[model samples]
Target: MAPANSSAAAQRVIGFIRRTQAPRQSPPPACPPVKKYKSLTEIMAKARYAVVERDDYSDVLCDQCGSGERPDELLLCDKCDKGFHMKCVRPIVVRVPIGSWLCPKCSGEKRVRSFSQKKIIDFFQIQKCADLKNKCSSTQDAKKRKRRTSLILHKKRRRLLPFIPADNPSRRLKQMGSLASALTALHMEFSDDLTYSPEMAPRSANHADFENGGMQVLSREDIETLEHCRAMGRRGECSPLMVVYDSCEGYTVEADGPIKDMTFIAEYTGDVDYIKNRENDDCDSLMTLLLATDPAKSLVICPDKRGNIARFINGINNHTQEGRKKQNCKCVRYNVNGECRVFLVATRDISKGERLYYDYNGYEHEYPTHHFV
Candidate 1:
């Protein structure tokens, strides 16, 4: 220890000695230095759970914009109760359809009072108006003229009621909205027509274009081939299916009415094998069936006459309930002398040697055209 009062130079040397004697801490562990992600999307990718799907995954994507379409960050409108993105909102106006602006935070008693006193319609009110209109149209009561005319006041009810019965849950407005949305989504899909692979089907696609009048019929040979081949048929080792020709277009035969009486349908050969055994098969190499000309326009097997293959074998029935009810196909021909008919399903255009295809369950209800097999 220095004397009671040390000199300034001596005091400075003592302070330096004390500072050097202080305990040193272990150096802290270094975290791997954070590598910066390149893009804004990459930086915010962790928030994927919060993001909405802008379009279906398989839809054609915009290279610059990533997966999203005309989508924006979600925003709830204060006035209209309508859903729109933050970017889609229109400019502020003096008056909106549903009345004065009030966000969820601002939905106080005063806002509710303003909403009610004003004549603006709500989402539920629209539904009510729709229901009233439907009731007037269905009842068709001239004496109740007010019900027909007062659609606007009951707009919500009228909109809900038009297409089908209320008891049928499937007919509900929400379900229809979902269906419309789904159909709109389908429009985004790249169609087979737009995305054809030429290497895989050059001649075939061109031929279809020609035959369907999407292009000119290429030649007279093509027309002749179309008609001859249009008369399609099938042979059978398992099921004998004769697609007798007929036409039932531009008309819907009533539920109880006769299926045969309706215009055009093909006739079948009354042969027992054709009536009970023709199976529908589509292997291209071996069996070739020929179309027969007769009161019963039938099909034939080229190689054996003894069937090399089968014809139709599905739910579509051979004939009308009045004519025949063959399991697999019972007797297509009820009367030995009279004609028996078989209707065909035209999924594809039948060319020569391509086995003629038909359904066994019933007529081609899916395609509005049905003529005799």
Candidate 2:
């Protein structure tokens, strides 16, 4: 009985020892719980609801094509707050533009077009000047007084009208066609009516020379003299006037466009010496005589050192009928603000390109060209 009890106790002790010493295997992990997922319809409903609630996107997207996957493929417009993809834009850009980007509508692409060259014609193709043709076939008596040899044509006429239709019409047309093609190649437009009007011509080209364009400032002595003359009920010579030239009228003086009626043109700055008769005296023949002031006392003004542009005025030889019609300007001695001043006042509205002229002494038989020289 003692052996049987001891054997049973030993068996229990050995089992307990084996159970404590041996490595125990962990129970297999319980099967993972089945994950519950929403249906496709429910997912789509949620996505649509989110889009309806917030119409704007959180990430930067293209306004043009609604593409946002590629950040580098977008171009922002400078004119408008809109983004566009490079592929969706008209005239598609291969790469990003460096400067500000303007959409097709913002940039004036269709408004400008290349000018056509088929509408232009030669300058001389219009008509031949009647005045030149008439002068060519004038009487010998008319040619004797005012010789046609003295008529000096300007060089600008050659540049303006290089072709004469009478000489070679076919060559002239060919040259005009060549000029049109050349202008077209250079991206230039040539319209009809090649003549330059007053409004069309540049304001700077109206003056004789840029150096003698504006009005000169009067000296302090001249100002004092002006004031003194004003007190004596004479005219003053303080005005903004300029000297301009034209092909027809030769050298003439004109005031600003706005100035009219009783404007001071220039001052005769010579010494007002009293001569009994300027013809009898040993004075130069270029002196202007004031005869209306005093009969016996001939007030002669000879501008040797101190002279203005008024000295360059030429004598109008109106012996021919054409000369009478060509006169455009006139000189007058006026009491300008109390100073005695000789001004070249416009008899009519002086156009911008029109030349200034006056009858020197009103004796139009022969012109004294030597005095002006």
* The candidate that achieves the highest TM-score relative to the unseen native structure: 2
Off by over 4 Å in 2: 1-264, 275-287, 292-296, 335-341, 363-373
CA shift of 297, model 1, Å: 27
lDDT for residue 274 in candidate 1, whole number 0-100? 22
Q: What is the C-alpha RMSD of each candidate to the true structure, in Å?
A: 24.2, 28.3
- What TM-score goes with each of the models? 0.19, 0.28
Per-residue accuracy of model 2 over 1-373 as CA lDDT, tens digit each: 9999999999999999999999989989999997554766455545544543563544656776677756667665655545667766554454578866776666754422222333323321233335754335433323432332133123221110010011243433443443334333223343211122343232222221221222233344334433432221111112323333333333344432333332233344444444443444532324443333333433445443234444444445445445656555565443333233454544554443344455555532222533331
lDDT by residue for model 1 (1-373), tens:
5674578778899999988998987889989999787866554443332332344333333232233344333333333333333222221111233433433333442212212211212211222324676445534532233353256346643211111113332223332232222222222211101122333222222222121112112233222222222221110001111221111111111111111111112233111222012444221111111122331322222111111112212232344552232222221211111212222222322222222333332321322212233
Give the C-alpha miss distance for residue 79 in model 1, angstroms.
Answer: 32
